[model samples]
Target: MSDPATSPERHPDAHLIQQAEVPPLDVDGVQAASVGTGVFAVATVIMAVGYDTLAAAGDGWWLGVGISGFGLGLISLVYTNDRRRRRRRGEKLSA
Candidate 1:
């Protein structure tokens, strides 16, 4: 029987498998927010210009969908930013 740590064949490149500690970035969050804002702006325009056409469903269904999508995107953007901030501060990212 041979010791695993002393055998080169058992643990080759052990130093290369180490994990690095780094903070998360906000590029993705910013991009998501930009896209969300664009969607919201376009939806607002549609609602203003074609309210009558879109209100065919007794109400403005498309408007609601657009607004919801925009809201979700914004939420995602904010959540991502918060995660990045927490990561920078060495906080645990569980949620």
Candidate 2:
């Protein structure tokens, strides 16, 4: 006798799971990083422009937040670009 839990015939959604085959999309990490960095750069500029108003409202930390985000995004952009270049050149990535 087969266990009910182990039997695919008794399991709900078993057929659906077996038929699920999603194709992977080809994506560029460098492009994604560039977009993220651009967004952070814009946010930093907006924060800088609103610093005085935000400070008066006790929200001056927004500027620091923006700066940190932009800095991190820049780092990501550089890292992604380097990785993409290395990949194009067939270099093995360091684990």
Candidate 3:
């Protein structure tokens, strides 16, 4: 009454299929963004005090750029963590 082709034991490789573990989005993005923010902060301080100090008087344009970079990194980190939280709750992303 049993067909060999339809039997699971007939195919030993059937149970061997394994799924790879996926990395969490928040962990990946947050780490990178935090590092970026720290780097930008350090660079901003160095630029504000080190280079062309007499001319810019700590108001250099590069300081603004570095601050912007830090802000953007923090925003991205927050977004990434929020996405991870939503995913854990099994909520779908809205358009």
C-alpha local distance difference test of each model: 0.74, 0.80, 0.75
What's the candidate order when arranged by decreasing lDDT? 2, 3, 1
**Model 1 lDDT vs. the true structure?**
0.74
lDDT of 3 by residue, 31-59 (tens): 77778879988987887676687355755
lDDT of 2 by residue, 1-95 (tens): 98766776675645434555887552437777778778888988998988899999999998888889889888988888888789889999898
Cα lDDT of model 1 by residue, 1-95, tens digit:
88767876866657536678988764437666767778786977778688897687577777777778778777777877777688788897674
For residue 9, model 2's alpha carbon misses the true position, in angstroms, by 10
Q: Which residue pairs in model 3 clash with each other?
A: none
In model 3, where do residues sit more than 4 Å from their true spots?
Answer: 1-28, 51-59
Candidate 3, run of 10 with poorest lDDT: 8-17
**Model 2 bad stretches (over 4 Å):** 1-14, 18-28
RMSD of each: 7.6, 4.8, 8.7
* lDDT at position 36, candidate 3: 84
Per-model TM-score, in order, reads: 0.53, 0.72, 0.55
